[model samples]
Target: MDFNENFVLGCSAIGAGLAVIAGIGPGVGQGIAAGHGAAAVGRNPGARSEIMSTMLLGQAVAETTGLYGLLVAMLLLFVKPLVG
Candidate 1:
């Protein structure tokens, strides 16, 4: 490949790496949320509905960062700048 093409490919790889880094927040947050949910369930089995709802909500919020990373990765792979 030409120098420019190689550079663009390198940048795309770098972009993917950077985007994946964003996943850390969501991963940690999701883990925390899961732990809380499990604790809550263990503490009060009767509140399972509430605990589950809250857990799902928190998990959904936490997932946004990872989704953003996925979006960036998809953009890098499919919408590359060098296609022209």
Candidate 2:
């Protein structure tokens, strides 16, 4: 490969790595929410609906950062700027 191609590939690899770094935040946050939901359910058998709703909302918020990472990786993988 040309020197320029090598540079681009290196940058793309870095970009992909950077994008995936967001995964850590969401993973930890979602795990926290799940743990809390499980504890709440265990403590109160009649509040499953409320606990599930809260868990879903928290998980959805956590998912946003991960989605951004996925978008960046997709762009790097399939949306090259050059045509030739």
Candidate 3:
């Protein structure tokens, strides 16, 4: 590969890696949320349904960040927008 091609590939790889790093935040956040949800459920069994629904909704929203990262990494790898 020419220098330009190599450079593009390198940059794409780096960007994809950086994009994937976004997953860590969601992962940690989800874990913390789950822990709190479990604690809440334990403290108030009567409100389990409400707590579960709210937890699920918040987790789903948080999960979107990881999904966005995945999409960005996939685009960088497969779309190759930087290349001619």
The TM-scores, one per candidate, come to: 0.85, 0.82, 0.86
> Which residue pairs of candidate 2 clash?
none
The 10-residue segment of model 1 with minimum total lDDT is: 75-84
- Could you give candidate 1's per-residue lDDT for residues 1-84 as a string of tens digits? 556677888789788888888889998999999998999999999999999998999899879989999898888877886544
Report every candidate's CA lDDT: 0.87, 0.85, 0.93
- What is the lDDT ranking, best to worst? 3, 1, 2
* Every candidate's CA RMSD: 2.6, 2.8, 2.3
Which clashing pairs does model 3 show? Answer: none
33 Cα displacement, candidate 3 (Å):
0.9
Off by over 4 Å in 1: 1-3, 82-84
lDDT tens digits, residue span 1-84, model 3:
555787888899899999999999999999999999999999999999999999999999999999999999999999988877
Model 1 compared with the native: what TM-score?
0.85
Candidate 1 vs candidate 3: which has greater TM-score? 3
Name the candidate that leads on TM-score: 3
